[model samples]
Target: MNKTFYSALNKSTVVLLFLAMTVSGILKAQKLPLPPRANDAISGSTFKNQIDTLSVEDSENQIYQEILNGNIPTFLRDLVPISFSKTIKDSAYVVTYFVLPDYLAVGSDTDYFLMPMTPILAQKIAKAIDFTLPTKQMVDQIWSNASVKLAPSPIPPSAQMTTIPVMWEHNTRLKGKRKETLKQAPLGALVAGHKKDVIISNKIYEKSSKPVVIYGWHYQNGTPIQPVYAGHSETYADYSHGIRLVQDSVLVNNKVHLISKVLQDIQKSSLFSGEGVIEKPFYPVDKIE
Candidate 1:
């Protein structure tokens, strides 16, 4: 995370205390876990649509305003119960938090996913919470519920051509080259490399260019092919682009943190007071002396 970015977070009204223990200096470093390998197959993930198909349109409000007024904790507890908002549903959210985060909740399904692909943005505003990019299948499942048709992919997989590899230097002196192509050892070989090497048959590719087809949008051409991009960017998504599905998932990892006072009650009751450090590290011990 940028130092300037850290200074910006302390100035915001977003409550980050809920996530103190999840990671050290997470605000200064967006070290979210890699994409989960969870089986993203759509098994009961989707639920019946709003009693009547929702006429929800996109909403672009200040995330700070939404978090403050929405009482996000309550929304998380419900976990994707049908929401009725005439103006906005999670389908189209361009909300910006303090570090310029943009996302919204498609709080319609059972999991309550967040879909703004901005991890840096999340840390900047959602200081305590962490997020994981929905798996390829998960993205498809949730985006399927969107109000509009998704865009078509601009690139095609089958249409691409394979490039041949060439070595910069030859292991043996170019003197006894066997292939007719290599035999012509043009002086150009010293500076300009050969057209192609036959030994290296495999084509070189950074990654597949297959597009993520959903979200009423398309994600193409990223390092790992994140569905979201800068304009509103992932197969896995980037730290600063697009939305992610974050709802109950935010506090699921921080259950103890969410209910801080409960721990206080347990401590005061002294129910497990005699336990060793395993149960209560703070418990006093008799001196060895």
Candidate 2:
């Protein structure tokens, strides 16, 4: 009887030890932390190469969509991918526009490069991101979205140069020497979709000899449609009038070739999402239809 009792006691001790070991292993596994970050930026040439090799058969293809879906390691939260149909240089180009975050949404207003500047000054700011005002079609594409709304100038009320009515009146007519008509474009128009109050088209023309005109959006009034801001005969300098930057896009061998030096710069500036959606929220990439 004593031998049987000792044997049972030893077996019970072994079972408990085995259970403890199993529990310990699970606890250790659960406590493991995330891996270290490389934080490397994708170069411009590398970006172009990726786009070239991408098997973009259509909207359903996963290649270009992968980049749009954040498969790329370094991506900006504020950079929205957009494709709008437009005719450029006598050829059709469905270029992608990666929108910079609204000036208000980038943590603080002062953190960004361009706050308020004339169109000429805005071009200088565009240099920081290695972008420029692309073909007129690119501007029209950005304004194509329904979420697109008007942003009023941030200038103080005292600096009033052109009233909304006069600006609209001037833009509604046929081509003329627009230099005299434009007073000042308030600071609001400089940034895209700064306000949702008004909806307007963003296409502006500033050819040296041609009449400057802004293809305006119709605002709801008693009945008639109105216009938005455009350049003038003299320099139309105001804190409100601004310009947009577009990275170069071209069709090579019938494939979309785009170079975004802006994204790389944003990463270097530490304004990127390594894997977290913490800062600079943006819209999804629109399907090419």
Candidate 3:
């Protein structure tokens, strides 16, 4: 080969090596494996039907058990990447985390239900599956990076808002929106704005009653309808509530770190949290009776 051919080959090798390194970093950062869905696991719609007659407490328990048992949709196993850049003391840093493409659901890929449960139950499932709830800042990042953004559809305020029937009704509406969105964006792409996230906030620690902090029902234009609010009791879960699991693993400047550890780090916490040092970034789980 001539000198020109040799030089071109060397340049190509360098580009290929850089691409390989970039892919390696992404794979290493999102190494958590989602549990396989059991063959006998019921679909989300079926589970909803079974729980329709059950009380809120009973239904919440069922949701927790079902999720831990891996009775979740296959599609949810596809985690989407969300990242942000921060400049700390003149040094540029990038933090990234893998998140479920959509809200937690119960069922197989063909049939599933977007299940909503109390924060206590959501926390338990998150712990069992090696995931963590997102902070308010993380929620914003997800919304901003989402490929498919649905507009929030809030039902009129009524006493029945928290009922199971209302949940199913809301799910029906979301299904329609998701169907339309998929036409424009591929399946398993990051989706947001359909539901309010059950998030981890300092407000959860402020009250003795263990309130459930919820946020992020964004519009298509990157505006959230609900701000970070912890007004409801920990057990209160409505149709609009969703659980978006963040893999416990996070990449801080391409180095792998546990999300909990990163959030506790004073310097790194700013990447994920606007509020400093989320020392206890977890929902306090009240024991099920």
lDDT values of the candidates?
Answer: 0.24, 0.30, 0.83
TM-score of each candidate? Answer: 0.22, 0.34, 0.87
* Cα distance off (Å), candidate 3, residue 103: 0.4
Q: Candidate 3: which stretches are off by over 4 Å?
A: 1-34
Which should have the higher lDDT, number 1 or number 2? 2
Candidate 1 scores a C-alpha RMSD against the true structure in Å of 26.5
lDDT of 2 by residue, 149-185 (tens): 4423233334332333222222222112112222433
Off by over 4 Å in 1: 1-118, 123-133, 152-216, 219-240, 248-289
Tens-digit lDDT string for candidate 1 (1-289): 5677666666432346434644233223232222221343221113112211321111112332233233221223212211111112323312110111113332222233232322322322333343222223223333333222212222222211110000101211111231233444321121111111000000111124322222223332111233322221112221112333332122212232211121134332121111111121111111110
Error of 1 at 182 (Å): 65
Ranking of predictions according to lDDT: 3, 2, 1
Task: Name every residue pair that clashes in candidate 2.
Answer: 150-198, 152-188, 153-188, 179-232, 179-233, 186-240, 187-239, 187-240, 190-242
When sorted by TM-score, best at the front, the candidate numbers are 3, 2, 1
Q: List the residue pairs that clash in candidate 3.
A: none
